[model samples]
Target: TGVSKGAMLSHKNVVSNVLQASGAYSPTLDDGAEFVVTALPLYHIFALTVNCLLFLHKGSKNLLITNPRDIPAFVGELRKYPFTVLTG
Candidate 1:
């Protein structure tokens, strides 16, 4: 069976993770200019830390994909933003 893993993560931990990741990429990434495509749900830890908080902290706008399964619509949306970063 296939099912999403759901759990609660502490704010401190999530923030720490985001900060750590941001630090490493900050040197090469430009602020307020990056467009990030987040295909994974924000509730997921990976998306929450890297796609949302980390990128947002770096002043990047994230295109949250509510329904990633719709490839046609997702691809169409991509044309609207000049995405420099993508994560799923």
Candidate 2:
């Protein structure tokens, strides 16, 4: 894959992407058992797709952090979850 600015995506594209991406990772994924620490704000595309939708489709437990600036709170949140996957 090459790098470029993000493209605009439709809801269907997103759903398809999540399904395909998760399928690519299925061999390593433990359906409904992964705990994900999603530090990124869901407003962003990468987080919205890979962090939120992808994991959600996998039935993962997500810890959404609206603010990642507060170091103390972020660390505290991290401590609370036995996260197997993280976005940062």
Winner by lDDT: 2
Error at 69, model 1, angstroms: 0.6
Candidate 2 Cα outliers beyond 4 Å, as residue runs:
1-7
Candidate 2, residues 1-88, lDDT tens digits: the string is: 7876777788899999898889899999899999998888797888988889999899999998877899899999988879999877
lDDT of 2 at 34: 97
| Candidate 1: segments with Cα more than 4 A from true spot | 1-8
Give lDDT tens digits, candidate 1, residues 1-88.
6996666678888888888998899898999999999999887778878998988899988888789899999999988888999875
Q: Count the backbone clashes (under 3 Å) in each candidate.
A: 0, 0
Tell me how far the alpha carbon of residue 70 in candidate 1 is from the true structure, in angstroms, after superposition.
Answer: 0.8
List the lowest-lDDT window of 10 residues for candidate 2.
Answer: 1-10
